[model samples]
Target: MRHHSTQIPESSKLSWMLLPTKKNTDTVQSTTDVLIKAGYIHQSQSGIYTLMPLAQRVVTKITQIITEEMERVGGQRMSMPSLLGPEAWKKTGRLESTGSELFTLTDRKGAQHILAPTHEEEVTSIVKSMVRSYRQYPLRLFQVTRKFRDETRPRAGLLRAREFIMKDMYSFDIDQQSAISTFHAVEQAYRACFDRLGVPYVVAEADSGNIGGELSKEFHFVSAAGEDTVLTCKCGYAANEERARGRGASGADMYEVEGSEQRVVVPAMRRPNLLKIKQAWPDCGELTLEHRKSGEEVASLGQMIALDEVCADGDYLVDAAVDGLAVEGIDNFSNVEVGDWHTAQSGDACCKCSTGTLESQTAIEVGHIFYLGDKYSKALDLLVQHDGKRQPVQMGCYGIGVSRVLQAAAECSSSSRGLRWPVSIAPYLATLVPLENNMEHATSVFATLSNICVNGARVFANNVIVDDRSYLSPGFKLHDAQLLGIPITVVLGQKFKQSGHVEVQLRVPRLEIATCVAGVDVTGDGYEYKAFVHVDQLAEFLVCALEGQF
Candidate 1:
């Protein structure tokens, strides 16, 4: 097999390469600063950015990885229009549900159009026109395109940008069971994609907001700067804090309290409405009630009974959080205490296991997968004939924030030096730098490396560059290389001058080297270098080293 060259030219000659210096700000450091300094992207507006050459290459590489994984899961790539009619959204009732986050506009003819934040309705409509029978079930269609949302405050660079790239896939099936199988398949594909990109992520049970689904999962990259709160238990149970739930101890104990004899009888339930209780006893001062076992003040007198003991005639309803509390019984209650009514919190006992305790962490949501059932299919009248009966198509939606992944990669990989991109998604694999006025030697070395084919293909033609800028000093060139976060840097000046050898440095930090290079030193924190290789063996050495063979 012949390998095609993917070599990029020197930065000095490329007019479009705009590597700007870092801007001064008092806030904490951000990946955007590294990106700006490395010439990857530039801010065009408050929440928009122009992907420069370097950024474009990185994004392209990430997209390629995603495309491969998506294809492996039988996803058929197609294009969807960014602008959609209001009727589709209105039919799904998302036009109002989406609130101000949706960007709406009117055309010259006074027809309302929305810059689609998602394509569920449109995709369902398109599939509806094509498939009318259950035989067309299990259809997986995907597209990579721009999505627009009118965010109230689009901050965090690409993470919360107003316009961003997204890969959305919709799966249509004959029933709920088939949709579930497709859902898991898509989930595994997502895992493969993120794994290939070297992103550290966690899959958490998430709330199905706006997308209206019975089950949803989110792939979140754990970072301190993340916007979502995640709760995890050692029992392997994890969930987004918004939808997280926990089991409570059985409410079986009760005690008598001395208060106004006027027993305010309310409904009985697992989690009683505390607000309604407060309204019923507004004049009642702090009613301090103690826990039945711990003797801690977990509830008040006016609060509903915490124990599961049913009131003979009347009892106050209280949440399970105050269960087993010593409280006076009230008369005349009807609601039964059934359901896990306690809100999950950090350090709470894990409901899934007997020993694990839940812990909380912040994470960024880069992708989401939802089992949408037949919500949209029913709303839009998307039905297919199954066994001579028409039924709504069971559907699922999966989305990856393509641009957010780029930023997330930077956030996860960057250090004090700069953006340390993983080799899989780096703009370029290696940077060829010459120390002194050594363009002649540098060019010769670059040309040889570019022509040396690996596996019957040019090794690094478009993927290698020579820092041929004569005006810039060696120190600046090296600094720029580090800032750009190229994984490998090869120098052909001093070492080659003294001996017929080229110096190669693996720029990945010691901790990260293990992720990119297999048998490298993982004990320290900084860049590592291999002994100089003879000039003639430089290309082969680099190819093998990058492939982690050496």
Candidate 2:
């Protein structure tokens, strides 16, 4: 793990990845682009990518954390097939239901096979054959493997790729109560895993989405570049837009009644909630609602009005003709049209706690947990004998999109300088930079770093990198250091040569994260914004910082 500048790839020198978007920049580049230009990944196909060595190192650390957390929660590691037969999927109706996302292929013998996007069918098949006695009622089996899906459009780097790494765990239990208990246990493990990653995240209610389940939640990293829209309340109620529900506006919002000179105002169900409207009018299956902007498809975001810009009172009072009547969308308002209208807005009262208003933001989904009753077990015939009667085993499935979490960490953390990472998953813990053409000085500091240890292990050698490219300028090295995301940087320069001190810089530090201190020989140049340490007390300083004591 000891790396020198020569050992690293040149693609990593693309500092252009961190370029900030200027005013009126029409296109916004996301973390995916940043990762590509920075040489962490390479696109092999339209929706497939190859992780570079540095990216692989970071991915390995993330996998290790997930594996440790999985083991902590009583999960036994095991591998399942990436290619699955269609029988079980057919039985579960997922063969047809899974639809386009499924990757299907035919062998030379003309037998069809599927590249699994998930393993519920395969895992259930395993349990059906192996576990039957109620004594073995509770079981948790997991695996870290590559998964495939035929994405219509894959963007956002590793966040939504056709092929990616995933950690999937399946839980089996004898009864509903036991299954729910197992679900909570796995939930805790997910929380612990994310907590260790050091990025802020949210646990929001979620829809099962192609993967069938009864109870579900999503673990999200809030980011402007995220594709999923999430609605949250200060009261702790959060859900993805697909599953989020807001109470109907008390009164029909003011609008111009189409085909008439009358402006109307009344309480009405928005076209945005067309499905809910259909629930009230079961027979009106053909009903359709449109946005007031020329009545285009209302199902999209063009219909959502910002609550903040609207009336502060939540009562959108308008001086209409006063002849407007209150009626739901079902009472023959299908052809009714108007100008721009309103739907769920940020300031709308939260459905969970009325005191809090619903606010919305986009977020990346890195993990998902589902309480998947007996659907899979029943379809796959995973029955266990209990009290002399066989019953379908209760089950649940949990998944962490391993690669998605990696890129999401970058998206959540990167400043204009470049990508950032949590200490636990950074490619390396520290970097050694020789501020002059002093390879000898760098070698000396590297030896000290290499000698540093904790619990009798050579942790530093395994987590430290020396910038040995003597041809590169000190400023260039420092600039690259910011983009590399190695937390502790030691600089050997004129000051170090004069006083046996090497300046240290801690990138993007927060005082509250950890509690440990080490002395610096002296402060850095006055022109600099901050000086982390002078690489003084080197062993104690780096050991603590790399161990998340920064």
Which candidate leads the pack in lDDT? Answer: 1
Give the worst 10-residue stretch by lDDT in candidate 1.
261-270
Per-residue alpha-carbon lDDT of model 1 for 171-218, expressed as tens digits? 999888888999999999998888777767888988787897888899
Best by TM-score: 1
TM-scores, one per candidate: 0.80, 0.79
Cα misplacement distance, residue 114 of candidate 2 (Å)? 0.9
RMSD of 2: 8.2
Error of 2 at 516 (Å): 7.5
Over 4 Å off in model 2, which ranges?
Answer: 1-28, 253-271, 274-286, 290-323, 327-345, 450-461, 509-529, 532-534, 541-550
Clashing pairs for predicted structure model 2, backbone only: 251-267, 252-266, 252-267, 252-268
List per-candidate RMSD values in Å. 7.5, 8.2
What TM-score does prediction 1 earn? 0.80
Find the number of clashing residue pairs for candidate 1.
19
lDDT of each: 0.71, 0.70
